[model samples]
Target: MKKKPKLLKKNEGLNPAAAAPKIEPIVVPINKALAIRVVLMAGLVVLKT
Candidate 1:
């Protein structure tokens, strides 16, 4: 029973480490999309002027 708890703790620690990479990829694309949208908006404003 003690060993099982230890294994669970180790898995819990690794879970976040594993999940972080997955989350980062998602965030990067979102940032890239936002950047593209900002650039497009700036271009539109400049063209209007």
Candidate 2:
């Protein structure tokens, strides 16, 4: 049996990319305190994943 092809609405085809969150570049801090926090958070994320 053959199934019919789906027809997308005006924005349906492009909606997924548009709906996704945009990623911003991460800026590293020169300050020691802020840098440590960022490193810890990144390490935790890596371990979790």
Candidate 3:
């Protein structure tokens, strides 16, 4: 029983390690897009002023 739980824990750990790289690529693009939009909006505001 203890061995089974240890194996499960290792699998669970690996799952996130595998998933984290996938998630970061997706998140980074979103952040870059948001930053780009913010910069554009700021530029527009400056132009309007």
Candidate 4:
């Protein structure tokens, strides 16, 4: 007879792999860089005048 895998009922912390939350990578858009530079330049121009 084949043996079955033991079920984890009482000890939840025993499984480290399943307990961890999945992390997804967040990416920023490239166009945002240009917008930031424009805003900073406008601030500097206002400050200089």
Among the numbered candidates, top TM-score falls to 3
Instruction: Evaluate residue 4 in candidate 2 and report its C-alpha lDDT on the 0 to 100 scale.
Output: 27
The candidate with the higher lDDT, 1 or 2, is: 1
- Displacement of the residue 15 alpha carbon in candidate 4, Å: 47
Q: Give the TM-score of candidate 2.
A: 0.37
Ranking of candidates on lDDT, top first? 3, 1, 2, 4
Give the range of the ten consecutive residues with the poorest summed lDDT in model 3: 10-19
The parts of candidate 2 lying over 4 Å away from their true place are 1-30
The better candidate by lDDT, 2 or 3, is: 3
Q: What is the Cα root-mean-square deviation between model 4 and the actual structure?
A: 11.3
Candidate RMSDs in Å, in order, are 6.0, 11.8, 5.4, 11.3
lDDT score, residue 22, model 1?
66
What does candidate 2's lDDT look like per residue over 6-44, in tens digits?
334335446756433321122223466687989999999
Pairs in steric clash, model 1: none
On lDDT, the candidate that comes out on top is 3
TM-score ranking of the models: 3, 1, 4, 2
TM-score of each: 0.58, 0.37, 0.60, 0.41
Error (Å) of candidate 3 at residue 21 is 1.2
